[model samples]
Target: MAAQLSEIEVKGVKIPLIYEKSTLMPAVNLQIVFTHAGSITDEIPGLASLSARIFNEGTKTLGSVEFAKELENRAISLSVGSGNETLVFDMSALKSEYLEGLRLTRELLRQPNFTKEALSKVKTDIKASLLRKESDFDYVAQVELHRRLFEGTPLEYPSMGNRESIEKITLKEVEEFWKKRGVLRRAIVLVGGDVELEEVKKDLLSLLSVLPLGEEGELVRYEAKGDLEVKSVIKNTQQAYIYFGSPFSVKNLREDSYKAKVAAFVLGSSGFGSRMMEEIRVKRGLAYSAYWRISLSKSVNYSLGYLQTKLENEQQAIGVVRELIEEFLQKGITEKELEGAKQFLLGSEPLRNETLSQRLSSAFSAYYRGLPLDFAKEELHKIEALTLEEINAYIKEHQELLQLSFSVVTAPKE
Candidate 1:
């Protein structure tokens, strides 16, 4: 079943609600999403992420362990996390324990465990995780790529922040960030599975009653740099980790999004059958696998892809990738490639919406992107009717993606 969209007013704030009722599973999942409150809005690198981490530490009154135990006793799952563009609180429980789950969520939001001890512990853990990632060449390359693409913007920083940034985060800053950003004005509530709309609105009112109507912030879209620069990191690894990105200029996000999907699939995102995989891996054996995708979002738009290969073949692999992309822009995809992409995308549509949560996520995404709730179905129709000429024209139009920049992690000169 599809998710339905509606609105509910609390404290004179109208919040959009996405809901789907299903009785097949005796459980429910709710997500409280805060827009323009994620890493993109962080004043200090990782403030949004640290704020989410603190929120997950449970209530001030109960503390982390006891608060977790209370939820564990009822087999409920609740978590808070931040991504590039939004912060989310997710909760899931059996229908019988839904209200109890909501109770804990409210408590967590109203009385977060923002104590000094919790802040120190979370910072230490994040630092340790960052230390471990030092050895992860893939992570190193990916971060470096973003650093180059969005050098002066908030997107340049890793979502989890760096060691220095995390160390500089104080408990007071996290508290301030949450108090200002986590407001009713920025929230969109999503509920699905075994619940009625009236019940959901009542539960949400009770859960959100504690939040203040803080000022809403505007989201700034960062442009990807198109300087065609190459940055390399010297590491002790035998295999080279190479990541690449460039500007994906789409003038209209909504009208061109479906065409971009089909183009992305045939060019790189569809794995073995895609252009990148066919040329880089199967054709020349440059790497075991390679991938690329068009990341179109509210805050940023770019093309990102990565691959790994032996140190000796790193330059050749990079050249082949560049040539492949240039050729793709020049010649576009074959009719066979277009048909294969359409078949796979259309055929796999069912699996994508097989669950209530998936449907809810889709509905929320539509709302977030300013599209109709039925956009998923409409997108399928567009994909099905897409012509080869139209797709090729779309591909040839975005030659800006050829201004590729590379981030490579490889061994030092022998």
Candidate 2:
């Protein structure tokens, strides 16, 4: 029931295949992920996202509505989405409809609706979405945090792009970006559910043969800037939206990552019982909830957290956040906290792996992070045997996390 890794050779290029067979339902899911083709590689802000939207419009021959109807008739779901570091074409259909799904996927890839009409429609949709986000204080705060942390880097730009950026995007640019990024070289195939591996491999060879050979671009890694600066935005809001981040250097991902997980869980990730929630919410009454997350990936690494409180209590909440982080760095976590984190993380293993999609995602994460396919199983073993001293040592070593940068959005003085 575990996802396994294999490879298919097309045009002398090896494409990674991550798959798992599950007969629990008569359904299948597939995701063709392109590396180095996401927002990080965009020469123009939102080019990657814009290209994905056009791909979702179906083929040039069928047009959007008719193409969608064909898939709906077969009960197939096909879509393209972009992330910070990759673009994915995802499909799901019944076991019987899978062949039709493959044929449709090829059609989309070979003849994407890159016309002026499609570009105008997608641009209008994205611009409206961007306008709506202006009213979301949390979104505004998070975007500001990224801007301050990544300043000159690609990460600074919003993935969905501002209205101006979307307006500047054109059909020709979208076509070029898609043609350059969607290639045999960048593809990683993930297919599973109610199919044999041999049959899947044979079908994939034909489905992927249509992809043009493209030059792979380099994925640049960005580290959170340790500025210790507070940037405030004036918004007409009752509550102050606070977003905080700092650098978290992961020296050895495989050896020290489990410790980071436990440390992060004990510090801020676990709700109610976590140190951040216990101090900021339970004791000080600064906010209803507080949390923190450690994000480590091939393209970026950082510690991010957020909370909201009354505009009147804004400064006090920020101070409490700083004090808690400094205290955590100085004192590390207690044995009780460590034990609780371990118990919770270990006990929740089954829930995390209960479904086929979860298994596929876990496997993809392992491959994406340049770790072994069995890394998840091995990580559980490490967490179960981890010692308090070891986790504390790891926590104390990450002093860079305390160089916090704050992005606060609050109402103007009344």
* TM-score per model over all chains: 0.99, 0.98
Give me the runs in candidate 1 sitting further than 4 Å from their true place: none
What are the per-residue Cα lDDT tens digits for candidate 1 across 1-414? 678888889899999999989999899999999999999998899889888988878899999899899999999999999999899999999999999999999998899999998998899888899999999999999999999999999888899899999999988898889888889999999999898989999889999988998877898988999778778999999999999999988788777999999999988999998988988899888899999999989888899999999999999999998998999999998999999999999999868988888888888888898999878889999999999999999999998989999999999987
Candidate 2 residue-wise lDDT, 181-237, digit = tens = 999999999998999999998998899999988887788888889789888999888
Model 1: worst 10 consecutive residues (lDDT sum): 248-257
- RMSD, candidate 2, Å: 1.0
Model 1's lDDT to the true fold? 0.91
lDDT of 1 at 355: 83
